[model samples]
Target: MNLAEEIQKRRTFGIISHPDAGKTTLTEKLLLFGGAIKTAGAVKSNKIDRHATSDFMEIEKQRGISVATSVMGFNYKDVKINLLDTPGHQDFAEDTYRTLTAVDSVVMVIDCVKGVEIQTEKLMEVCRMRNTPVMVFINKLDREGQDPYDLLDEIEEKLNIQVHPMSWPIGMGKSFQGVYSLYEKKLLLFQASKQKLDDTDTISIENVNDPILNDLLGQSSAAKLREDVELVDGVYSDLDLNAYKNGEVAPVFFGSAVNNFGVRELLDCFINIAPPPLDRETELRQINPTENKFSGFVFKIHANMDPKHRNRIAFVRVCAGIFQRGQNYHHVRLDKNFRFSNATAFMAQSKEIIDEAFPGDIVGLYDTGNLKIGDTLSEGEKGMYKGIPSFSPEIFREVINMDAMKTKQLEKGLMQLMDEGVAQLFTYEMGSRKVVGTVGALQFEVIQHRLKHEYNATCRFAPINLYKACWISSENKKKMDEFVDSKYRHIAQDKDGKRVFMAETKAWLQMVQDNFPEINYHFTSEF
Candidate 1:
């Protein structure tokens, strides 16, 4: 296919949700529809003797939680779909945030019982800020949960997004019948199957009051569905593709991901309406997906994907044109041109080398430790892509070496993990004391686990007396030098050798800011 045709036929999106909200299960079901996997892996259960495909890391499998983003690609209904399963735990928000930049749209999973949790709210806020197109999947309907209408209201209020219900559940819990797909005007009766998804009994109803619904489901359940449909229609306007594309509206779907009920409805509607690869903003200009020359950006760098080989893969989202293997492309940050002989596409951790990839696809490039997060590449241009920034860390701890003989390994692992964007590593100028900063305490555990298993390095985290880490710069070179000299104890450099001030307290930071008005302290690395 031509570049335009290829771009039009591709869909790239990220799956996000709160922990235990069935996000991974929903991904497995979607892959099932796409014929990517033979049988769905049990997310939290070991009965199947399998773990979630997205949870490929050993730590993830043991904890039953996703700590890193995993990419999977497949073809369904003649459309190439690139799905990124992101960590739902708040500790990995940095990684998830970067994943959002590579995706054209988002599928937010919410538990029917919990509605919207704290992590879900924060993730939605990020999407709202970027005006990213989103679709909601209300998961786990087989279990007794909140009233569907009440859950929808909670989502609308808490998420701060107007929601249009594309599909509504008939009866939840033990009385659960099925879901009515408003988009296709069909009724899909629910069935409990722990193994895989089978073709459910579907009946197209041009009319909601059709007698077949009553015959299939009891009279009361059928009546409730009709009443709910009428109320939904009266309350919300019809789904507008343009409004959804603009991120002004979200189309919601209800389902039990584990049972594979109502998942097809979500996937079918998604492939039909979800926006394809759109233009990405760069420092120069917006690069359209239809452009003839290849241009893409690296949003994530993962280390030790294969612990034995100690492989690090740079995940690049193809933004424009076609990426041909062995073709030389300009690395904008490094200002060098290089050719990649191995460009692999992902199915969780397993990958196969591909000769070419098109826009809206994520291809992994093998790295020998040079790639960093937010690095941009192009056919020949020198411009960089914008909007990929690291947020200031909320937690800080000093890394204490546990094995003296492995000090070099410890340092190597720390630097490599920092480059993966999981945390920020800083070094004290005088003593060279290494400190790690993260969004949550859990990240320290993930890093520690990776350090031992993958890097063969061991270290313990000791609490450091620091409130925040800020990158400081100033137009006045003399003043900046004097500030660094005055606060020598608090001076440090980040992984990229950028100067940082390790604030002892908020009051102290405020005092310094007031005293040195000319000096600028940026909480995020964007400036």
Candidate 2:
């Protein structure tokens, strides 16, 4: 297909919000309304198992929150929509950042009552930094103690973005109705009763084609829709929509994603207004070792289900030319080349075999053989794609020593943990003895559980004082110069002649680097 044609065929967007803001509910409703799943499933109960597409982790189910990014794809109006459902908790914020690297836009979901919280602010900042277009979905209109207008104002004031309402809630709290599409200027009312697709739910398309639906269909009659279209046109008047038929304005659609209220309309709006991959600004970056060679970046990774081939699956975003299976591609981080024996397109968890993939498409390859996060796969020259920022473990604890017989198993499990990118492994050795470092106290519990379950190695843990080194500028040039040259960590005296040692460090620095890599290493050692 032509680039423009392909652009019109797919939509890539992510769902983000603060914790308990109804993001997963919204995701399920989207799947149900888009016909990806037959039933709407609740995260609380893994009812259908299929509806839990985004929350695939056991910890997420136990904790009742998303811990890692879950990817799902569905079709609306012949246009494929790839949805990246991100974690809302502050601890897993790194997963959100990594997910955003592969998406073109975001559908920011917010709880009406909470408005914007710390996580929301952090996510908005990332979106702004990336210049990714955003659409806000003020959710939980059905819950008590919510004010849509107030939330809208908060979003505008805090985020400093245009708060053009594409859809407005008809009522708030218990009296919540459906939504009025501000752009379409029409009200979307959902059936009060649950809709089950059988003989009754099926309606003839010809019979449903009435004047009201016609009005909803036409751009001119839909006042709010027309206004939105016009506003976008005024902003890009010189740019003709027909010239770039796939291009569209950022649209916000409101609905109770939990009750499946106004969900169909929202999906329709997404297919109608969201820009296709081809129309988006082509992100130019190095893909391989050869400066001119074609390469792609893997955005998501999965483990295959089959026992024989239950290896790592790399989901690649083709940034440049075509990539074929069984070809050797350089892994930028590992500094080695691995061959993708089988490359395929992923439909949720299902894999579709494909020989090659082009730019603007997401494909999965199995047995990437030591491939890692931020590793670029290219044919000839060594070029690097920006790596996904590492996520910091918010909590930390120390692992107690295990028996000698189980030490090897513990090390193997640590390697597995590192491979998953869920936690970091820090090993300190003192005369053949080793100590492992983790993010927080709770992580030690998880590590112990994993050991018991996976390796049958039981262990205990203790809370240790998370130590750090700090320095004060006493301005003692002689001491500072001496400290800089020594291999052993030396005390630096600044101009004020005060000694600076490792005593001032804290665990907070690790968390800062984990959450905010954009500024982590920007300064030199002297600074």
Best by TM-score: 1
Q: Give residue 105's lDDT in candidate 1 (0 to 100).
A: 97
Best by lDDT: 1
Model 2 regions more than 4 Å off = 46-51, 192-250, 278-294, 300-310, 334-336, 391-395, 401-403, 429-451, 454-461, 467-527
TM-score of each candidate? 0.99, 0.74
Model 1, position 16: C-alpha lDDT score: 99
- For candidate 1, write residues 1-527 as lDDT tens digits: 67888888999999999999999999998998899998988897775469988888888888999999999999999999999999999999999999999999999999998889999999998998789999999998898999988998898899888899999898888888789998899888756875666674777888998888788888888888889999998998889899999998999999899988888899889999999999988988989889889999999999888877878899999999999999999998888888888899999989999999999999999988767899998989877999899999999999999999999999999989999999999999979999999999999999999999988899999999999899999999999989988999999999999999999999999999999898999999989
Alpha-carbon shift of residue 299 in model 2 (angstroms): 4.0
Q: For model 2, where is the 10-residue window of minimal lDDT?
A: 518-527
What is the Cα-based TM-score of model 1?
Answer: 0.99
| CA deviation > 4 Å runs, candidate 1 | 47-49
Q: What is the C-alpha RMSD of each candidate to the true structure, in Å?
A: 1.1, 8.1
Question: Backbone clashes per model, in order?
Answer: 0, 34
